[model samples]
Structure formats: structure tokens, C-alpha cells
Target: MAEDLHEIVARALMLDRSAITDDLKYNSIPEWDSVAHMALIAELEAAYDVMLDTDDIVAMSSVGTIREILKKYDVEA
Candidate 1:
């Protein structure tokens, strides 16, 4: 699950997996801006087989937050 999350985030943000740290936050880097964020969301949803609501989407500001949000949906990462 952790590997999947890192791969999904990396692919969505056009970044190397090593760059996806728990501290990585949305809008913190050019690759993680709004457009990439939505792409990341789509990738996460598809990979986890879960739909994220508006609040969950908004709350996914960082890798740590994203893990927390996925936990709410029973997705352990």
C-alpha cells in the first residue's frame, strides 16, 4: 500500500518516488500544484477503489494528511 501510494503520487506529480516524502505538501512545489493535485486525487481514488468527497479532497494537503484521509476510507497506506 505504501509503495502504491508513493508510485501514484510520483506518477501524478511527475516526480521521482524519492521526492515523495510524508512532509511533501500540496502547492509546496511546482509539480504539486492544483492541476497535479486533482490528478493525484484521481490516481489515489482509482488505486484505492474509493471516492473522495470534497472535504477529503480539500484535506489532502500533504502526504501525511493524504494517508490520514485514506485511513478514514479504510485504506491503509
Candidate 2:
């Protein structure tokens, strides 16, 4: 599941697979800024087929947090 999450984040943020780590946070990666945040959200929605709430969007801060947020929507990642 982490691997799949990594793929989505990497593709959305235009990052290499190695760059994704458990400690990775939204703004920690330069490319994971506002613009890419929206893109990442779009990618996740498309990939997982779930629409995230605005609260969840704002609450997503790190890879771990992302996993938790997705779980709220019944996403296994």
C-alpha cells in the first residue's frame, strides 16, 4: 500500500521514487507546494476513485497523514 501511495505521490509531484520516504511531508519536498498539492489531490482522487473533503485536504501534511486521511474515505492506502 505504501508502494502504491509512493507511486501516486511521486507521479503527482514529479519526483523520483527514492525521494519518497516515511518522513516525507507536504512542503518538505520543494515540489510538494500548493500547486503540486492540488495536482496530488487530483491524482489521488483519480487513482483511488474517492473525493476527499476540504478538511481532509487541509489536514494532509505528511505521507503518514495521507494514509490516515485516505482511510477516512475507505481507501486502503
Give all candidates' CA lDDT scores. Answer: 0.89, 0.88
Backbone clash tally (model 2): 0
Model 2 C-alpha lDDT per residue in residues 5-77, reported as the tens digit of each score = 9888889999998888757998876899989999999999999989989999999898889988888888888
lDDT of 2 at 65: 94
Could you tally the backbone clashes for each prediction? 0, 0
- Please list all clashing residue pairs in model 1, or write none if there are none: none
User: Could you tell me how far off, in angstroms, the CA of residue 36 lies in candidate 2 after the best superposition?
Assistant: 0.4
- Which 10 consecutive positions of candidate 2 have the poorest summed lDDT? 1-10
Candidate 2: segments with Cα more than 4 A from true spot: 1-3
